[model samples]
Target chain A: MKKRKLFILIEGVDDKRFFEKIIKPRISSVYCSINIDTSAQTGNEKIRRYVKSFHKMGADYIFVTDLDEKACITKKKNDIHRKFRVRQDNIIIVVKEIEGWYFAGLSGKDINKLGIRGIINANTITKEEFNRIIPKQYESRLAFLLEILENYNIRAGKRNNESFCYFMNKYVSP
Target chain B: MKINKLIVKNYKTFNNLNISLDQFNVIVGSNASGKSNFLSIFKFLKDISFSGLENAIQLHGGPEYIKNINTKGNKNLSIELNIDFDIQPRLVLSMKPDDQLKENERFEGLGMTFKELKYKFEISFNSSRKYKVINEDIKFKGDLSKLTVGESQKIKEDEFHKGSTITFSRDPSGKVTFKTGAIQHFIKSMKHTQLPILPMQFVKVKHTELFLLEKAQELGLSILPPIATTIQNISSYDFDCKASKTATPISVRNTLESDGSNLPIVLKRVLNNPDTKKQFYSLIRDCLPFIDSYKTRPLLDKSIMLEVKEIYQSQYLPSLLLSDGTISITAIIIALYFENNSLIILEEPERNVHPALVSKVIDFMKDVSETKQVIISTHNPEVVKYAGQENIVFISRNKKGNSIMTAPKNNEEIQVFLENELGIEELFIQNLLT
Candidate 1:
């Protein structure tokens, strides 16, 4: 049997790493036959173009982007869908930023290991808050983040973090 | 010698990459995608052979900087090259953390190590960051019947050695003996364990009593000679020639300098040789038609100043007065004409030049590649277009932030896009090549 091809477009190398190293390993059994085409982060314009082009080429994809301080998830999702002309279900907007999802997915112990203590809300974590906690470097911070996630066996799904899990369950898995 | 394959691991940006080479290779990537880092591999090898491993690492901003950041704790950075000589010989060199050398080893100056096996070679650093040759082997390409008695004994001893392979310096007269004059010559040639193996010039391979050296004029061992010649001839041009325009002291130079600061001297030398001068002028005229002529004038201080004459003007103006684009193009033309049967790695030839001239440069580079191997690192669409899909290696960072190298021929979507819809440049601009 031929596996269905699922294309994924994301904003940066970190997001791509999350999908490949973190999410893919955990869901391989369920999505056994599906082929995933994850693109290197080329920027927002290229991501928009790729989403449209991949759709036209007869491959379904999930366009992942940050909410970028947007007030409402619905508004961000609608804007992305209308702008890129992608299906509403195919768009996954990370609240505030992808770091927020990372914070949400990791347990209190894992968060403490990352040097953050007493974090009340992971979902509402802003980019600034994340940057304050773990500064960025020329080397992707995600390399370190993925290492932490792997050590704890923390899966990137709805149970750990809602937005990431939603995309995994709804689009990534068979 | 042409490199057929290259494998790099734990090097900057590259986690583990294997790239096949072509006569003319154009490497394109986004910023920080490791295009220049990839080209630096050639320079790195040349530097190691020329100035030993510690100096090479130090010159390149230390081991910490050269080693890939994403590599987990204590992983060794390695580069393996398969060069097509008489027979394909694979050379592997790995740099490991060197915090463990003994006090005596530390005091034993210029820490560098080299290990050689029949077709395999390894070099690593001791605990004190000093390099030492750990293993050396010599294996023949064909059947065991071809092996001399000494060569067979050496192989057997190598197979039985428990620890690391026998070091050539430490075991000068160990169990293994060899009849292959070249292998014995290489083993006996090592005067110190601290010296690097690749820099045959300093190591004095030419003076050795190897059979190949005795018959150097006739029989050619494709492997060693090409590796030596290519390493010696490897030239890198960053095209920063602003300092060359000034009236600098003139020194006789047969080859162009890396930064082109000696452009006047090299240009003078080229003009003196009629064959090279004609080709240089023709290339310049083709690439920059506005120029009537260029010459060097000796100043009172014995320094030489370059002068360029515009076609419309009768009086020649100083080279310092010319635009950056003209000087850059002229330097490139000179480099292309002078370097013969060598590998040239150029970084971002499109910088500071007009698009039309950039195309001319690419065309000239293509022409040069017929006689010599040329690898260019560029982000220009025109260069990528002119080089075509087959000659280009697209480099991108994988999800793990590791630099991955890919070619259009290996990419199905890129092939489909090239065949059906857009050109290579369009596909590149759309970021579809990844």
Candidate 2:
């Protein structure tokens, strides 16, 4: 088989770190290579042209967005297509927000250590919700996120969130 | 005094580059495009005036460190400045109180008049890392008023040039020339025994100091000292907030240090002045609203520390407890408002400052520029946006890796973007300014 090239467009630095740290290590294919960039790095207005150019270069591309206020994944994908004209298959929507994925990746012991006392549905958590629940020990939101990233359990992430499971099934798992 | 033009040759990232300047300037460039190098030129001139030529060279990392590696010719570096003065040189005012009358009489006796001065200095190095001043020149130009009969007779008897221009030049061979015969005669009559030793002059070097400022003073020219003083009055700063947070001794408050280590002492001095204190407090309230008031206290060790009182808290927070951004902002305000210099050069004034507060700093800088020339180098798009196209100088590199500088207003493409209502910051972020 010919070698495959892939380009993934993310919203900002946090998403770039998420893909680089979590998703990149799980890719076991010997015939494929991936490049990740953020809209912030390549200005937000120019991302459409960037995706189009990469597509013309015979590289597969993914445009990742958050299903923030949208009703469903289909509505969010349609909104992204209106701006970037990306294909439906290449649009990956994180449920509610990417912060949800950070929570989804934490083990039960990590959740208890964080002082949350109720049942957790990681898919529905927003950034504001995560900020409200962050323990008093961390000084900043970035500090809390960094701690979560340090102790992240990918197996728990796949088990807790359907969007993360679907992404792994499509891109990472054989 | 204002520097109207700069012509540099074989200096660091500049290889035969000439650029015009204004009272307010914002230099923007990509990383490693020589924005810092451009600002360093002013600091280098300042160093040369205060320290000697050899020490200035060593301060900039020795001879070989500054030579342009891309130059295809001999390793010779030169910088020339064309300066225009709004007021007369007032050389007597700067003299000692006792010698002011004598210096004023010396100026009156010379019958010298000039509105513009051009000074150039050049240096070359051999392969052994030894450097020598190869050339130095100063030319004065002014309007010629009608001369009295005695003055005309004096000019005629001395065989001096009749035009309004006076020229002074010295070469590496210790050959000095003057367009005016009387000044030439006066210089020759001075004792060469009092001349300081010219560094790196291993054998057969007759010239004393490499700088013409010292030579002019030694010759009692009464013209070059004030001009050199104008050039020496420039101060460049890249404030180090960490160093600034320490308590500084009260005795070292001559001027704010380049790293802002003496911020406390300077702040003490600033608060003592009622006019500057009012302005400082207003700016502090606008820039940092959380701080309600500030105080400076003296320790038994004769050191002073700065503290700020928060609106929500009753006690004042010491400098050690303050954040880096707070100290950085405070240092910038004091440097801009308190210190007086002919030119002020700041490198990344936005460093450690929040994005929202950067516009306030740039606004203050713009206001300060109206009184004194202000030049800054920044990577912040907010600076590019607020500085406007007319004040922005874009620096980029060509294929050979030589830095090229151009004003953004002169570029037609940028003008078109501006006409279409695109923000300058957008153009900068999209990499369209280059």
Candidate 3:
């Protein structure tokens, strides 16, 4: 008998985090024998490539992606299903928005009472500086970054912060 | 050519896992045993394979957002998909945050790599990762990398090339050349079709479902269309969708863009092209029996505004005159009327269409998929049922939130239970298993 495999996908870590922090601890036993994973798009060219692989797999698979940041994903997922002949239930997704992000900033009584920290952990301008391009809320990302730095433990010698500096380096001289 | 196997390590959902697929694999689990997340790997690898490590991180929002946080510390996420394309070609991709730090987007820089055994291709890079093309192999492969860097150099088998990596082909001559840019192009070919989706700040109210319908002609993995609608008027310019919100008539003009955004322009050109005007009338009649004969009288040609009338009632036009599905249908007709092999990817084809028309719309898609690959991403069972198992692909997430084709059981009990609960019909076995 083949060991059944499972694939879980998502747009960001929020989904992974929430499920791990909130969902998993609750339903630890019911879901088993499931080899699961999550991922998001790198970009378009790569998306097509993966779609091809999924089709070639010719087994049951699922694809979770957003809709309409550029155009609709309706066709892309469908194309994979048709080519691979996978089951419809295997292809699931949250429609146009990221389902987990909504859970990130969730407010009101439950949040305050639960002692849930805000998802955005870092607030430094360092994040935007690395993009070479920047979004308006660069400072806001600090809330998210601070959490990252705290958990990551950056060492001067052990840590090479190229990704931390890529966009920021654009404006600053070496 | 089916994927009967999968192995993953330190991925988003699984710490270490392996699984096999049934041809018609239906992954049914509680809301979040990593169902949706399990299915995300394909999208992730697709983004990376087709674009590169850099673009994949950006499209995914950021690298911090991608790395799995479970089990402590940073772990390299790896993926291997064994595919049988007549001959089995194994594609493995792996990545993690770059050791170097930058900014949020750039600070989220990652090291991504791809390995395809068929082509013996392997490419890897990070925020500062660059390829040092070997000179020896370049001569044998021909001007593959010359165009990328704009300079070429010579190096003996014993000598190393500066800024250039050395390549020694297996050919008898033992030629010396640098690596060709073929790796880049091969990776670039891995693209996001059916439009890539990024998490938005908000949810959409009237969100569209990208439904898969056959063009009734396409048979391959490609997304080409089966039929092309020939429009009589090519020079009519753009289309104007002047129909109102409450109750307005649909108007067609000279040309309509594939998205049907040009309905407004089509409304403007109705006066010049009688056939277009007639077609517009017929469409209104089919969609809105309340709409009688209507004419496009230019209120302002520069602004591209027109008046619509139905004998008893006359009103200024807006998109609201038609129901959401009616507009979509009109959009489909208008877009299809003039396009060729240009595959139309609809988001939620079931939306707005009456249940009666839903089946027809699907039939239309079935016809289209024959000539062109009509790929759709939908959760609606109706759409799924319409396209049949052969056209449906279920998506879910794993615990760590990586994507997978078949739902990961995490263990044996869940798999047995799912099979028992879902009743993997003998019919399903036929579709998914050989």
Predicted structure with the largest TM-score when compared to the true one: 2
Predictions' DockQ, in order:
0.05, 0.03, 0.01
Model 2 over residues B307-327: C-alpha lDDT tens digits? 988899999989999989999
* Candidate ordering by DockQ (highest first): 1, 2, 3
Give per-residue CA lDDT, model 2, range A1-174, as digits (tens).
Answer: 786656787787778778878887677263255667667555545666555555555557788888888998998898788877788889999887888888899889888987877886899998888888888988998898888788889899988888888898898883
Prediction 1 global C-alpha lDDT: 0.63
- CA deviation > 4 Å runs, candidate 3: A1-174, B1-259, B266-301, B305-318, B406-434
Query: How large is the interface RMSD of each prediction?
Result: 5.9, 8.6, 13.9
The collision pairs in model 2 are none
CA error at residue B177 for candidate 3, angstroms: 8.8
- Count clashing pairs, candidate 2: 0
What DockQ does model 1 achieve?
Answer: 0.05
Measured with C-alpha atoms, the lDDT of residue B235 in candidate 2 is: 82
Interface RMSD of 2: 8.6
- Candidate 1, residue B164: Cα displacement in angstroms equals 27
Model number with the top DockQ: 1
lDDT of each: 0.63, 0.75, 0.37
Q: How would the candidate models be sorted by TM-score, starting from the highest?
A: 2, 1, 3
| Fnat of candidates, each listed | 0.00, 0.00, 0.00
Query: Chain A structural similarity (TM-score) per candidate?
Result: 0.74, 0.89, 0.38
Q: Say which prediction, candidate 1 or candidate 3, comes out ahead on TM-score.
A: 1
